[model samples]
Target: MTQLVLHTHRQEHILRLTMNQPENLNSLGFKLVAALRASLQEATRDDAIRVLILTGTGKGFCAGADLKTMNHPYAPGEPDVLDCIVELFDELRNFPKPVIAAVNGITAAGGMELMMCCDLIYAARSARIGDAHCNYGIVPGGGGAAILPRLLPAAIAKYLLFTGELLPADKLQHYGLVNAVLDDDQLLDHATTVASVIAQKSPIGLRRTKQVANEALDKSAADAIIHERLAARDQFRSYDYREGINAFLEKRKPEFKGY
Candidate 1:
């Protein structure tokens, strides 16, 4: 992939999507946003890609929206930068494959929102997170408002959004925003390791599992259970399920055929 803004690399069914524009602290500008959207959509259509990894090059992951673009002339709903972020959130949330966020440094405001969109997030111990939008006379137009409350306690979400204070990765991990925290140098390694395991799973199983989980997040327990039962029964009849069970009985790794 060209390094204009986003770089996508695929190996063994794992796609690592790196945010370019390291010189700009990986800010999401128009070109960068467009590049990312295109690359993600391309990966989405590839049936071989079972796992998606989101990270950034250089010292920082993403600082926020491009300050320069903030002043550019624009028309009504003419594909604003926030639109790009919303698109990304939708992609990650709806992706048939599992999406993991690997954050190495500060990821405030929109960056944090992007991180939150991932199915799982791993961060460097020193990485930071915050809703810096309040400091800029704005609010999170991304999925921040909707997701933070789900990831964290309602009171905790209120304090963070209200104060907009930056918190270290450890704190966020305790708050459930981050799945885990590793050494700065091991951030991507941990992310890739987890993604690799996910990539080895049956694609049909993984996709249905992700969809069911995402859909059940806001559903009642009984409703979620009903959906889960239906999903499990449907997937159990697929060829992959038979392979999985036979492989288990034979004590061999199953060769999943994405069915």
Candidate 2:
């Protein structure tokens, strides 16, 4: 089976991207990284795709980078692991649509970084997530260092980074990072519902809102206001904007064509 599985629910306009290498805990090896990148590119190009739900199969979400791949000597034709990681981080950060993380079991090290980058994270109550880079006598080669501090409190981030310990999903949820802590069986269904609700909205509005929200933290309040105004103005020009207004006035649900 492929390392990555991209299943498109065309009717819902949702794409479920599963990391399929469960035997290796869906490690971020060259194959998995390449497959994920290609899948994201496909999602980007497909207009019908509105929301992306990222999850993994079997026992673990991802066990960070494949030690086997990293330990092996590099060959002339091979892509650098660092390069692949950076590319994946960039793709996740700039993915136009909302990306929801349905985190299952054993999310650690770089896997935790990947989950943190998503717009929303819904975790299974039984899942364990943390930064375990220290355990291997190495630090994060990915964006973990940069992103974790931003997501978590200084003490919490330092504790995880320094100790390399896994924390239960409930603990993370208590920190207000995870959107929901759910039963294993309910994880996917809840994520799908969120995606379906978002998918029904105007695509341009969602994209613009996401763009602004993602960058808001980095911008000044005045700058964010200006940015949001510009985004709202652009949204007004979209066909769906008019459709939404008309539908509201007519007391009917808007059928967004993603224009």
Clashing pairs in 2: none
Stretches of model 1 off by over 4 angstroms after superposition: 1-3
Clashes of 2: 0
Per-residue lDDT of candidate 1, residues 1-259 (tens digit): 6566777787788999999777877887888777777877888789888899999887668878877787878897687777777886687678788999999787888888878878999998878888787878887888667788988999988777888887898998887888999998898889999988888889999888888899987899999999999989998899999999999999999999887
In candidate 2, position 10 carries an lDDT of 45
Instruction: Give the Cα RMSD of candidate 1.
Output: 1.8
Residue 214 of model 2 has an lDDT of 91
Model 1 residue 62 lDDT score: 87
Worst 10-residue lDDT window, candidate 1:
1-10
Evaluate model 1: give its lDDT. Answer: 0.84
